[model samples]
Target: MDEMMPHSHLPAVGVADDEPSLAGVIAEDVAAWCRRLSSTLLEETGESLLGKLRAEADILRTLVDGEGSVVDGQPQAPPYRDRKGRLRNQTNPVTSARNPVAPPMALVGSDGESEFSVVLPIQYQGPPKTLHGGYVSVLLDETMWHAVRTALDGISFTRELTVTYERPVPLGVPLTVRGRVTSTDGRKTFAEGEVLAGGEVCARASGLWIAPRR
Candidate 1:
């Protein structure tokens, strides 16, 4: 299904900060709360807590919404790049410390192949104790593109992604995701990736990435 999604022309670049910022820490905390809420069953109304959260959300929205940096006295718009000039959106969602929705994915290694360790929570459950197939596809696509940006030349976009589900991805268990370039032909680069649970392949994908013309 990832193949049918409209491709964005935005440049894919760079790794996130090696160290976590205060904001990143806060985001992760919020994400943790969200995960708890997802799994918890409430016998009574949560309106009081919901009200407090709504007020907090308003405060946060004011701070983050439409906020941009003043680079050299020039106000930049949304989607600002980091100090290292890497685009913010290109940060690894799987391993991002700042994104609340991002799973607790830790980077194991990335030389030519990008590898990550992750465990999907109940929020990502599609069926009884299994990871959603769509999320699996998205993760594979992201990892494969990360491999392309890490190992190939120039910026690339997803042209096609084919994901095969071998087994149900069980939630709340350790999983490994890995991607690497398999071959390159002219403007296109072919990459393959997989998600493994309990040392066995659960989901695997192959994708075509195309570098735009300069």
Candidate 2:
């Protein structure tokens, strides 16, 4: 958990005005910082960086609550003391996706819905630079249901999922997934997702999600 390793190489932050410009600079800095953070965590923990990250999220919570600084030019408020209080809570589903954790995919722009993209590396490969089918399903399911959760507020789980692959999802290439809820019936939610490469759809998915039973 050496914070220095990931962020040390990042460009020094300078004062900037407005959100857009500041976001661009902060994005670049965070990317570099994440790289260092991942490498350092791997070296020290002998576990996936995502695992270390989850373990340290509480500490990050404290820092974010105490400091309340601008991240990527967007001002963020303090962290919630409990899961119910956080703006976006990923702990439950993230824990469900255990065995091998999914990395924190970036939140791209949303056209009235939620969109995200994740870059798979050699380590994430399943078949000669192709992403594993299971991981693909996980990504699609998580993003699709998360879109619903983002728009509304509730705990949900995938009840059923159907994914169609038009082409093999290549590794090392950025895979973009976008999703939105089509409709909801009480505890059940229906959603759809599209996986894209170079702006072309490679795979599409539809899912039925249900609220987790208490």
For model 2 the TM-score comes to 0.55
> Which residue pairs show backbone clashes in model 1?
none
What's each prediction's TM-score?
0.67, 0.55
Error of 2 at 4 (Å): 40
RMSD for all candidates, in order, please: 7.8, 12.6
Best by lDDT: 1
Model 2, position 97: C-alpha lDDT score: 18
Scored by CA lDDT, what does every candidate get?
Answer: 0.67, 0.58
Model 1, runs deviating above 4 Å: 1-24, 41-93, 108-111
Q: List, residue by residue over 61-152, the lDDT tens digit for candidate 1.
A: 64344233222232111233655676554234455543456674666435558887887777788888999899999888877777877776
